[model samples]
Target: MKKIVSKKDIAHLDQRFRANFINSIEGFKALNLVGTIHSNGGTNLAPFNSIFHIGANPPLIGMVSRPDTVDRHTLENIRSTGQFTLNHVNETIYRKAHQSAARYDTNVSEFKAVGLNEQFINGFSAPFVQESKLKMGLELREIKTVELNGTYIIIGEIIHIEMATNKISEDGFVDIQQLGTITVAGLDAYYKTSLLERLPYAKPLM
Candidate 1:
């Protein structure tokens, strides 16, 4: 027997669903993206999850920050210095990454609170996490304000990248399972990654 999914039925399903669909969709993929930014006066700040690399042509990366109902440290720091760093979260320092997300006053430094080492590179004013398995410093390129939303999307041009020896592939592919990367779920939970088969790109008839 054949069945068709009516538009009314689809809409009903959304209302009927008990669990938060978004939470399940996003976290199940599993990879927490951590970021570190330096303040104007040489303060090192660390925050975790919800960052992704967009392009390599001009070396671009994107970050989404929730708007400041309280104090916007990350957004304020980036706005002030126009620079930030992205640190990929791994198993060795998962606890530190989690700590970075804690609520703190504008004067408090997340980096110092978590006991992570901050590294400064020449030619870039932003500080990066020295203890991170992989980290990169970027110069702010663009900032787009979302419509009717409290958050902001930030874009940066990658100026420098540091990585551990064993994790990087010969072709430069970052293997999550090899690095033991930790991922986030429901805005707070963390988990390790597992290996799945690599598949080829899909093609359609011409």
Candidate 2:
């Protein structure tokens, strides 16, 4: 039997329940740890599941920053330094990545708090997760506000990429599954993925 959750039912649902319900409905999400550093050199790391590909020509990426009603160190650091990193969360580091989401004092570096090592590449100001199998350094491009909900959409241009050469296929597809990258459902559930099959591009039948 199918269960129906009407509009009114959702409106009346408990806050935590509603959050879980809505978040899970979006299915699996890409999980990454965003790394940034404040002007004073205080580093910040936070896990985000909302990262998405914006375009390829410019190698753009986008992620959502929840409303700034409260202190958002990751967002603030990115804004201040105009640079950040996205580190893929894999099985070995997912637990530490998840812990990065906890709210800590502005002076605390989540990298140290969660026991993750920070790595810096030449000419990049932001830190990267040393344990991450795949990482990207990005420069902030734009921030758009969603007035309806007050969340901000942060967009960045990819400037540097670090990954294992074996993980890439001849055609440029990255085998994330082989890299052990994991995904998240709702706010807490973590999942590993498998590739079922690869199909050719679709075309109209003659």
Strongest candidate by lDDT: 2
> For model 2, how does the per-residue alpha-carbon lDDT over 83-198 read when each residue is reduced to its tens digit?
99999999999999888888788888999999999999999999999999999999999999988988999999999999855657778898888888999999999999888999
Candidate 1: which stretches are off by over 4 Å? 1-21, 29-42, 69-71, 166-171
What C-alpha lDDT, on a 0 to 100 scale, does residue 25 get in candidate 1?
Answer: 52
lDDT of 2: 0.91
* Alpha-carbon TM-score of each model against the true structure: 0.77, 0.96
Error of 1 at 146 (Å): 0.6
Candidate 1: give the clashing pairs.
none
lDDT of 2 at 76: 90
Q: Which ten residues in a row have the lowest lDDT in candidate 2?
A: 66-75
Candidate 2 clash pair list: none
Cα error of candidate 1 at position 149, Å: 1.2
